[model samples]
Target: MATPRPFSRFEFLIAWRYLRARRAEGGVSVMTWISLIGIALGVMALIATLAVRAGFRAEFVDTILGANAHTTVYMAPQRIENEFTDDVYVVPGRFSDYEEIAARLAEVPGVTRTAAVVKGQVMASANDASNVAEVFGISRADLEAMPRIVDPATSYGELDRFDEGIAIGAGIARELGVGVGDRIRLIAPEGARTAFGVTPRVNAYEVTYVFSAGRYDIDRTRIYMPLAEAQSYFNREGVVDEIEVFVTDPERVDEWSFPLLAVAGEGAQVWNWRDASGSFLAALDMEDDVMFVILSVLVLIASMNITSGLIMLVKNKGRDIGILRTMGLTEGSVLRVFFLCGAFTGIIGTLAGVFLGVLLALNVENIMAALNALTGGGAWQPEVRGIYRLPAELRAYDILRAVGLSLALSFIVTIFPARRAARMNPVEALRYE
Candidate 1:
């Protein structure tokens, strides 16, 4: 006597035969194709969306951490009493002890480097064109410490003779049609005190270096001069406006803030990059979540097609199922066969989608290049978002999420139609045939 077992070879053979059956023979070949295509498209969309989102996030963060400081220390608000008048007065705080403060802050466990910086707003002119620029008076040593600006591949010109001249951004060079060794004039509104009146001070300097920060705004407006020159031009002779600090890990910037404040002493304020870019980061996260939900719905809709297709398959094969039941085939065996049909479509569609999505994500830059070549101009502009292009980066977590969600939906939807086919009475199924 032979004992029956579940998911036997006979069950799979029946399922394979029904899957290959022609429409004229009451097969669900057409529905299977439709369901497979829908799921493939849905999964492809999810993978592509996630890859692009991760790319955007990484680019933004890199530009922030590489080109700018992780945290900045500024003079805190101060209030003083007027002894002569017995009236309270507010005096602007200046960091005369900036060097001492910088030394103490550098000792903080996570701190990597610190630089005293003087900033001033002035009108920059060259080639008879003028634009507003934010001038930073930084020492040559500090300027070279910046990874993005000092890199030879990304930046143009030499910083060795930085003290004698100025370093301007690549965007500024393009705006004013100036280049290395080109003459650019900076006009300060508050000039030397004269007996008659105050006049704007106009000074000329040769552009010794030009750098790209990979950010449109930073590259457009930043000009670096020697600390001494900036102090003289801005009439801030001895003190720096603030001290910019870099750290080992920018993500833990908040944790370092308290330690920084302790060393910075009284009348000092510390602000991290997050404080400056919080709103934009929050909006990006919200947009990512919304897109995921919308695309997941698309995937869910695609998986539902599996249910519809399997139901039609069960109805069409009713007579065959009735005959098999009379031939001593159990209901469980019938259910397994129908389940296999739906599972085949889901599994194959998912695998195809993964392959297609990965291809698109990895070759996104190549695709953009092809588009630009065809158009004889850039197909995508970086002006709006301030980066090179829309890059895609695939993460293992995201890929796994897509695969798990798709398979789960596919298996859950396949069960109902499969169970219905198994529960049908042989008499009723044969009567309909």
Candidate 2:
């Protein structure tokens, strides 16, 4: 008698029938279903986690880069070696000629825009309400160039008249119960020197523009004033605190840092956005890595179900195995048949999981809305998270990683049961029958 090819049509036929067999016929139909569902759920969960993590990173970086300068060149004190004594000495500094410095920096390659900014903290009060806010004094042309502040959907009022007064965040508008054309008093603790020491500077300005930056902290605690007005309010005439640099590619600002400093000249310091937010970005990256490890373990645990199911399947088909062995079925054929059973479960489950996970990622926002309605609100808080909605981005590499992990786990766990079935003794298997 001749042996058929390995994993021949007959072996698959036998495996298929066994999978479909009734429980009364000593089949492991229930275990098969259980294993399939487990792997599918595990894969789905892993994919979902990756999608949300990627989305979160994208959103966070966008928020940081959107509202901030790629880099900032500051007028700071620098140590210079004294020629006679060989001693290092420090001197006070300020960008009195900020326009010239900004122009110099703008001449560098990839530098898109430059603006001199005055920054301070002050108290804002209107309509019986008061709050502390961080103020940035910038020119109207530069403010108009800010995509987030000049957005039509979330901002209103006049950009043309921005030089005349102030542009306040929407959150400030709500807190003070004020609107466009309302007057708000700003009080600075460090004010002009007088005969009786120093007095706080108090001045009121009309709200010329109302803007919503879509970030909780910025919208709540930020104010924008015209550059000259800010300079006067801050008591810093003919000078700015720092010059903000906007680059074509913010992510690659490190490449331009040296050149920026070179053009900025002596006693100047260049600080990029990444340097300012490095700790925050590092924390996010670490969390994402941890989540991937945790979710991958979940997929591994779910794959363990395949081992138990296949073992039960091997035990149940002992009598059939004995008869097949006696009729000249080889050990390799038996192994292939049983291995194919688990492989089928793995492939199908992985496909199903990919489908469900992609679907979940695509509809996550809608689902979040539905959950919020069902729970009567409080599902997500933009104030706490600094984001208005949950974002999910399904990446192809992430999906492939999940599928590869699930299938690899399935194939590995199926080996022992398949081997056991292949090595079974025909005489012992038939003895109880």
Candidate 3:
């Protein structure tokens, strides 16, 4: 039974012995350790890079979906005459039967919830500045249900209590130098055409809550108000501009959106969240892809070290190779042995790198915090990074791909030196010894 085991251990045993050679036997080559370190660093960088990119994308998607609905059903744009300016006024038409549409959308397979909304653009003014902002008129119930990624401590509960209370984004609040309990003026463009030269509808709303939602654009330009007040203010009572639909699976937005569109018929326009942010998301994806390609070059450079180290190993063990060849070891076996030695280095390096990468990715926030604390809190700044913490999303597929790519390269690079050793003249190799 022990005699039969030699065949199974043949290549691996030789490779392991060569790797463990003592200092008297030329020791472990410095190049071998260098190759291992190189591979480890390259693999770690690739894993960490991919994880951080994924985290950023995931965080952005969640923030966007939380502030806005998964799918929105609104009226198609229509052209009309503007009495105020005698110009063509193209506007988003309103849907009067929003309740019916909401009810039908709720019955859709993937649809979980629906809320009617009145959305419009308005001019907002505070003590510090005046800016144009997008306004959402939502029911108290829907407002409560909408996720608040960033909450205002002083005014969080004020929205439900006051009819004229409004929630404004962080950017708007900052720009206006206003906070909870402050007042802002909202002016609607489509005011009644009275003999008094078309008075714009103006209303003062007390800032009730401030939401950040982790997005600067949304924070800069969004205000949420009660649906009833918004309907009255916008002069669209008993009608909502759109029905916002929440789905069970946001990834399958089309499945949820098409059914609502079909129920709402021809005058309806259904827009998924993807359509609104496709370009931004695409740019992020492309950046991740490009970064992956660039980082892979580091791994390729590390693989070259393996090639060099293997070439050195073959030269140093020329006599050993000749002895093995005379002892019934075929050229194929010799090649396999050298390949195994290099593969061992890659495998070990990759495993260590993966472990280190996962640890770093999972605790990046803590590490950054520690770094800041150690450096007196100025070394790592969130304001400069445009995000609060480093986001890391460890994906299994990405890790596996990185490891496979590194291993394949390591194996291929070993082939050249391995072949040279395998084809050596056994007689000449032993003559020097």
Candidate 4:
């Protein structure tokens, strides 16, 4: 039948009255609008910056994990020394039953795909340019699944033929000034023993395709050859170095790793995506935290604007405050009234800013494209960044956290000024009249 009003309602009403009041009515001060704008801009900056940072990390991780497995099961490293040769030692281990292990991994509930991989480093020479490249020997199907590190239009027919050709990154192609049908020489560091001494193993492979994984480092330094070819080149026939496993959920590495590890059996050591890329992800996390801290200083500065506005309001409303205090209004209530006035600005500005920031984050790619169109291209360079467009990923947690921090700082900054207004002497305040 009736609506009950709380102290907060009364405080909000007074704060609203002050906010809408004209110059003649001693309402809405100029500083209040300034403070509101300040808070709005600060929150907007924080949200947009954090969103971009998050997108950068997500895109990078996706690119890396797309071409690689979520987890790798490999034979543990062991030392093999030859007493007769005195200088012969081998630390790189290979496991045999990889096909069985892969089958077992595929049977796991969360496992999506499994493959046995042969990886090695070799010196690649095309024309005058020679560079060290990470070579992966994988099946045709798996190679297609990898991030098209080169133009897909480029013919890769030779890749289907065992030991006939190799796929190189775009970087390798550029540096070597070579393309499809070019011949590249691969020299493995491991060698076979001859009558006199050990000789370096060498082979020439036709370049069947070129890929661009969109990562500059990978595009320039990686190569792909058939798994059989890799094994033959590496002198590990009928054996794979590791069984790579992919899971439905890459984020839950710990959960997926266990079942796959179980399926891999003994003599196999497992490493998840995080195990290989943890340091890189950790660095991104640290940078995100640092950016948050730095941007928060803007909000703190905006809160100071809130403090200034409230202090001015207090001086202008001295007589009103005195009259209210004389009418049995408590000092705590007076303090609340002013505090609510400042808090209202912080709340409104923060909400507005967050809304605007979300819109910006969601459409950042289109926005960049539009900018490029207007600026006659080159505004956003994919060639420079290796990404086709700008990335902006908005997270709800980041928005809420920024809003909370801004409100807390705004609330805290209001205290000193609100207290002074509450403690004013009624007699002295009205004596001026």
- Over 1-433, each residue of candidate 1 has an lDDT whose tens digit, in order, gives 4647988888888888887858585447877888889888888989988998988888888888877889999987578888998998775566888889988888889899999999888899999899899999899999999987887987888799899899998889999999999999999998777897878899999999999988888889999999999989888888999999999999889999888888887778888899999889899899989998898899889989889888888888889989999888888888888988888888888988888889889988898889978987468666778776678989998888888888888888899999999998999989856
Residue 42 lDDT (model 4): 88
Please give the TM-score that candidate 3 achieves against the real structure.
Answer: 0.88
Assess each prediction's global lDDT (C-alpha) against the native: 0.87, 0.87, 0.83, 0.81
C-alpha TM-scores of all predictions:
0.93, 0.91, 0.88, 0.83
For model 2, the stretches where C-alpha displacement exceeds 4 angstroms are: 1-11, 23-27, 77-93, 374-377
* Candidate 3 per-residue C-alpha lDDT over 1-433 given as tens digits, one digit per residue, 9 for 90 to 100: 1223332586788898887756855534677888889988889999988998999888778877877899888888889998898899787688888888789878888788999999889999999689899999988788777774334542243655545599898888988999889999999898666887768888888998877777667777899888998888888889898999999989778776567888888888889899988898999999999999998999999989988888888888999999988987788888888888888888888887788888888988787788888999786554554444567899999899889888988888888988998898899999978
Clashes of each: 0, 0, 0, 5
User: Per-residue alpha-carbon lDDT of model 2 for 1-433, expressed as tens digits?
Assistant: 6879888898888888777868585447777888888888888888988898888778777766777788999968767899999999985466998999899999999999999999989999998899899999999988888888888898899878888889998888999998888899999997788999889999999999998876778888889999999999988889899999999988888998889889988878889989988898899889888988898888788778888888988888899899999988899999999998888888888999998999899888899899889888689777888866788999999999899999999999889999999999999999978
Measured by TM-score, the strongest candidate is 1
Better of 1 and 3 by TM-score: 1
| Reference-based TM-score, model 1 | 0.93
Instruction: Please say which candidate is ahead in lDDT: 3 or 4.
Output: 3
Question: Which ranges of candidate 1 are over 4 A from the true structure?
Answer: 1-6, 23-27, 79-92, 195-198, 372-379
